[model samples]
Target chain A: MRIRCPLCGDRDSREFTCMGHETYMHRPAGEGWGPAWDSYLHLRDNPAGVTRDLWYHGAGCTAWLLVERDTTTHDILRVELASDAKRGNA
Target chain B: MVKLVEKTPAEGLLPLEINGISLTELVPAAITSLMPFDGQEAAASALLSSLLGMECPHPNRSTGRDGARAVWVGRGQIFVVGKAVDASVARHAALTDQSDAWAVFSLQGHGVEDVLARLTPLDLNRAVFKRGHAARSLLGHMSAVILRTGENTFEIMVFRSMARTAVHELETAMRAVAARDALR
Candidate 1:
């Protein structure tokens, strides 16, 4: 697998670490405290198809990435900086 | 101001010649980590250009002028190496003292890329990965900054605490390549 880091360009997968789902983008800091906290802390969805998730470029650029990838086929559809995506959405 | 006595992290392994390649410790006269303050790209660019007398290369690339070189080492960060007249370049950017944070070494010879390919996930093929290229990658579990300083030379920087291990891993890879070459 390969990821094109915004800063580092295309790099091998070993340079990165899968963080978790992108749903973590919605924080419990808002009014959805209890259930969101439980879901953030405990519950995890194990879907077998394409999903948007977070990844940390631990060994490369050290950027947080939102990766849209297929869980079953292991094909990456897209990647973008989480910070940029958040800002764009806002 | 008083200055601490400088020591290269891999100084003890100076001139580590193996398999026709020489792994030598490097002590760049001035090594600094420069990061732009948030939303200060224009300001940072101006100051760095004035200080470096050259354009700051984008990430994954390196640029040099007047003996000073800058390599993008991380997101929004660059590691400047080589000698400079003034040390006050920090006045322009968010500076972190990296003179002690990393151990710098230069591996030079014909098979240098072969040795690095064993550790770097980034392809070291000469066709694409040539001089003025920089990358952050893992070298045997240690996060490293790899820079192609010349046609036959690569400068590697690993965290100071892991300098010894980094040297060992590099040497082991060099030896392995040599052994394989001998059998051929």
Candidate 2:
């Protein structure tokens, strides 16, 4: 599989590490430890298609990527800098 | 000033100069890692350009005269190749010294691409990855900055701790390529 890196262009999948879903990134920050921490750590839904995911470009660029991909076809729909995407959303 | 000695990053194996390729260990006089401060990319680029006497290279590119060169490492980051300049030593940037953080190796000669192909998944086509281009890619199981300095010359910079392993992997590929060529 090939992933289009925002900085390095399309590169092979070997250079990247999929860091799970974007849900973890957007977990609510609150006053309690139990519920928030549990949801953050354990309650992750594994969707089948068009999922927003996080991947680390470990070997190239070394940037975190927010990737929208189709889990069924292993097709990448879109990729953006995680920092930029997160900030814009925030 | 304390005197400095040069040492090659080898996995205790002797350096090779066979099958039209030679692996030479290099010690650049300086290796400063420059990252532009947020919103200071233009200013950072200008400073490096003035110092380098050329436009600062953009992503996956490199520019400079032999002794003074700049290789782009990633977005907002560059490694100035010259005398060791301190982090923040240049204006409009956050800097850090990486002179000792990496082990530099020069892989030169014909059939170089064959060896690299055995390791990295990236395209090493002369048309695509021409001289003066750099890429951070996997070299064996470790990550490395692969810079093409000449038509048949490449510089591989890997972390110092992984230097021994990187050299071993390259040496193995070199030998394999050589053997294959001999058969051909």
Candidate 3:
């Protein structure tokens, strides 16, 4: 697939890095350490279908992105910043 | 040929281009922008290692500044600036330059940090993302590389297809800040 960048113009997808599924779980600061640590380190929901993800332009300026794409066909629906999207909204 | 101004002052926007590339010469060094590794940290690191002909460690993070004057940014990411980048180095990497698929933009000015904060989740606090540090993070859904070129300027690299979208987002934020400043 052809990937695009804001500054460098259109480059091949190889120049970009794929950061899978943008979903993240922030550990509750007040909670006990064990559960939070486990969730932070080992828990991840690998689902199919359309999902949001993160990517980095390793060869470029190294920008991170939040991308919504189809896991089945690798079709990208949308891309944005993780911070721009409210937490848990993905 | 059109005459390109090396340094031109825009009312609300800072000149971010340096000889056409989104880079600038800076002192003390800083990480103006970043690209999030997400989950491909390992793969990226390995690729860099092969290209650099050195053991880049797992999930490499590069600092923008050289030794002593260096600072560290996020995990599993590297900062490219100064001698770190040769401009032509991209040709050496395994990745193909689909330059047509991406667009490059430069960011400068005192408010550059504030503009980045609106689009990114990573802390832009100088104490955290100080000079010589670089991180990999997301910016408004586009995969990008944010390089700190100076204290007030940054080099933002994004895909060409998303150039207009990213620029619009940046300009909108910048204009809002300028409007707020005007009120003050």
Best by DockQ: 1
Tens-place lDDT digits, model 1, residues B24-87: 8877777778887777766776767786675567878888842488888988888777754244
lDDT of 3 by residue, B1-184 (tens): 9997543112123333422223222221222212324555445445444544332322213332232111122333333322232233333322222323334455767767877887765566776655434444456776665645467756565554666567667776677666667797
TM-score for the A-chain in each candidate structure: 0.87, 0.89, 0.67
Docking class of 2: high
Candidate 3 global lDDT: 0.50
Which parts of model 3 have CA positions greater than 4 angstroms off?
A1-90, B1-95, B98-100
Give model 1's share of reference contacts: 0.94
| Model 3 deviation from the true structure expressed as Cα RMSD, one decimal place | 15.4
TM-score of 2: 0.90
DockQ of each: 0.88, 0.80, 0.04
Best candidate according to lDDT:
2
Q: How much is the lDDT of residue A13 in candidate 2?
A: 95
Write one digit per residue (lDDT tens) for candidate 2, span B37-142.
8888887777666555755588999888567778888877888876655344356877888888888888999879999999998799899999999998888888
